[model samples]
Target: MSLNESCGVYGIYVEDGEALPYLYWGLLAQNHRGHQSHGFAALSDGIRLYRELGMIPALSGEELKTLMESLPGRLGIGNVRYTTSGSVDRESLRRNAMPVLERGSRRSIALSFNGNIVNMGELRSSLGLPEGLSDAHALNRLLLRALEEESSIQEAVKLCMDQVEGAYSTVCLIDDGTLLAFRDPLGIKPLCHGCGEGIKAFSSESVGLDINGLDYCGEVSPGELLWIEEGSLHRERVRHSGRRAFCAFEFAYFARPDSLFNDRYVYEARVQFGMNLAERFDDIASRCDIVISLPETANDAAYGFHIASGLPWEMATRRHRYVTQRAFISKAEERELILSRKVNILGRKIRGKRLAVIDDSIVRGDTTRSVVRRLRAAGAREIHLFITYPQIIGPCFYGIDMATYGELIGAWRTPEEIAEEIGADSVNYQPIDDYVKATGLSRDELCLGCVTRRYPTPMADEMAREMWERLRSSEREGGRIYEG
Candidate 1:
């Protein structure tokens, strides 16, 4: 099976100095979003692109100077890629890495994007584009095609928004030093714009802007298009879809803790998630001797659990600082090995103790089961799992990795069954309504498709409905439904 990836995108336009440095820092701030590959495209001479298959390397002062000299430009865009819609093999990943530069009939452009296209087959067939184009490449082609036919760049973005059928938050560096940014009609992904000094930038999350000391300008509203060139900024609402569907999974599992969403920090919302869990499962909280987090992402939530339940929060599961790879995003075959080396268990703290373990979410049962086995071996007397995100009963067509019903444990098993399979005392998922409340966004503003089995976009909804119907009676299902 081809694995899926969630990615990060960054673009910057500097009126005086080179923009590559700013672009580099922005992508680095959000590298957690995508770990497989990194690339950059700068509009100097033409569109100079540099791509590699791995995380963005930490550069020394001399290395940074060399990179700046190689791709020096006042306008640049970069991406840390995770494949939501392409092959995951080494060659395929290398070939499909973003800052995907393409030449159209009239002009050349390089783009970095986050999110998936639901109607890729239809788009490819209708446009007569080639096979094997990743969703980002397909989007670049779509934009280039529109640019050829439309009178202005804004019109081209409008045309792409009107035709495309899934989430896309994109930043493009045109060959002529123009910086273009836009979000999908429904705003199913996170994209924001900020500025500092003579620098205007766009990123997948606010933490990128924060790292560069840029002031938070605001989000690129749903259906909005931004065109920047020669120190000027132009904005237009390209299409009004009458709703917003920002990916809810971002608040629960993906974004950095310091990242801002709807003016509130992600860690703040996760804390509320833990508090809600405590209220909902007070009996279980009463029985637990201590609260233990699954390291890194769940640390804040575990603190809230400790606060509400009055249980001591133990920093028992310490993540190895050097083991930077995320087990959740690694390929299936590599996930186990990464998880094993990811964290060390403090056997004395949890030994013979009824521990309440807090985690972000569980998609497939493998990672959770592995953690449970580790805890059991370390003498954990009891393990009750408190998960932040609601149960994922359906595949995500927007941009998440869980693409088939057969791969999602919640699609077929009850919480009690999941507990038994993972060898946990109990498994408690955050209630859907409580999760929505914690994010501070109304139900209409967030995409709960994976949890509720209802997608915000029409094509994704139709495909999911049909796929679920067919898979309901089958013993197993394989491959991404949208791709098929």
Candidate 2:
């Protein structure tokens, strides 16, 4: 259950003046999407990029002044990366931190991408590709070639839509002062467009738009290309696979609770998840004395559980505000210590109680096991783990950090086995269909590849099968299966 967020993409187009402020706050607001690295490419007379190997810095003091002075432009693209693709060594992460900028003799464009390229291996062979180049770089190279061969940005993007496969929600800036945004034909990652008094922007999540005071327009649709020039927005349905496999994981885990998906707030969906659990597992509910949530992501669901089960929703777990980093993305040895420092238990309330612990999802099982260990030490009588999302039995190749079958606890073991492994009295997971219903989207509209192993795109489907087989045989497969 190694849960990891994909990435964040943001762009702003203004008539003239500094665009760095929007890019600054936009990235800051959605920093939860990625924290390993952050960068932005501004399109002035030429593209100017400022990127680093850690979180986006606070928007104040000399950092803000220096950032604004360094990258000044009317149109720009920004990204925060979580390393779903390419190497994670500091050198590789530093080299691959994007908006992956490509400067060519004919022309150039800066792109900030938010998804993985499933057909990367096949795509690379066609071009004289650079070793260790990231998916964003690969996609940018493909787009540059298409632009050289085609007549317009629209045509170039259409070619990209046809050739590139897998999850991608991209925002780019052309040298001609135009802002272009498009989602992969499947819309596997979330991206939305918004407009304010005199500004138009694209963001990975609506919270970014909200923070910047931009009115939410709508999502950049699957297979849709949004071209904005001067204040006009033009939309072209580039290619429709007719199957929109929006990543369902966003609602359950990654996306900010304030963000909207399919016009429904993510927090509301999470609340529904708790209600569903209470109704579906009444026996467990009746036995529990209180509902406790770990971190903030599970709080809404825990509250809903309290209402439905007639139990107290105890705010016993408190998170340290300064400890903003997630344990799943940190180093293995540091993860346990970070988790310990991040959360604290109010032992008086937890002691001598049958507690129902609600969580977003159990990815690698370490987080759950650690929390359970803390509760045990606090003298809890029994800890029943109620997971909001269904067990993820397969790996995610789209954009999440969970890329291999061997890393997923559910892939190798059942819920009962997971309960014993995590030291919980019982581990209850939501049914896939019920989880889908709670999101207010049909099964066809969401990508359930990690949960059901039925990937939306062709290449990912093939790769998952190959990886699953290799893992089944206990092969020593190192590195990401999708990357090869």
Candidate 3:
């Protein structure tokens, strides 16, 4: 299913006149995380922030040269973002694009951040910020307030961590040209740092590191604060908790397949998901004539399914390379167009065949329903869906696009009901136990918040409960409850 990706946060600390290259490539590599707007804040003399709407388009030689000339700095933070909160209008897009720079009386901060803030309403009121502001804005204001009052950056970060709740993996630029990066107390988002020669960088995903040829350093620990000053870096275990809740959806959908999380590439974990599905449904696997996968994310898993079931994996569906609009964040009209028009089914492989189709997840039921209809038209006798991720039964508040119970088809429907609605003969999902094993993380280590309805952060859990009540009574129609 289509789901909006988390924003990508990138930062660089390097020699004078050297930050642009890393910033440019880092955001470019992970542009899939966000395509609506992109920008960077560089501290050349003071912080210089520039942002533009739409995806980072292809550039010729002259365009690249001109962009580089405009942004000059030794260290900086950058972000490519899509709205999970706040306004969605054009003017708001420009106003809210990161890196968000804020200044107080004695201290200032420019930050590029990922993850959602669950206490946004209270945070906005406490900061006395205007309504409908983005989570990043509210967070930047809160952080700026802390930086102004606290003597040390670490202390300020700790205070900020204590105040804000939910997922946040951030990279910030300080006034003195120092760079700091940190993760939320529960680590609901991914961030990692690595150094190469004279350059040190942090990114929301490892694909950014791979693009810059940086060494593969591990994930930033939960609640750890890391800073780079004068090219020398120091680390502090700012906050510690017995539970860690990294977003499990990252392996299932949001993160790039090449990204390394918990030492295993996301693609590898997805492949294991396929193997696990095959094992669980060996009876169904035996009846399938061929296995096919939805193009893109589920390709590796389909390959694994083929290996496990010993069935030929047919390339039955082909995606339109030019259709790049993601279904989750697109307007309803645009989403249907993209989902239906973006892929075509090969009649030869599908006609008169019993098929086991592998896909990532079933969210709103639109994308899958459309695909099933296409396959039916192609003469498939029976369709069985093998989904990589477990069924998402609850709304996701930690930056995933799904934040409303009404929008989630799996929220109240049983597997049989979902299959009937989506035109699948059977719908099979990997057991949550095996899904956890594939990530190389224990069940308690990952944020199964959406699937299990147990949130790591207190505020998100409380707000989710309130929203659930509203949703049940049909009192709330749309939008995130935390956004209230």
Best by TM-score: 1
Candidate 1: list runs displaced more than 4 Å.
1-5, 475-484
Clashing pairs in model 3, backbone N/Cα/C closer than 3 A? none
Candidate 3: count the clashes. 0
**Model 3: CA > 4 A from native:** 1-5, 469-484
Clashes of each: 1, 5, 0
Error of 1 at 140 (Å): 1.0
lDDT of 2 by residue, 416-463 (tens): 999999999999999998899999999999999999988998888888
Q: Model 1: clashing residue pairs?
A: 5-83
Mind giving the per-residue lDDT tens digits that candidate 3 earns over 421-468?
999999998888989999999988999988887788887788678777
What's the lDDT for residue 299 in model 3?
91
What would the TM-scores of all predictions be? 0.96, 0.95, 0.95
CA RMSD of each candidate after superposition: 2.5, 3.3, 3.4
Off by over 4 Å in 2: 1-5, 473-484
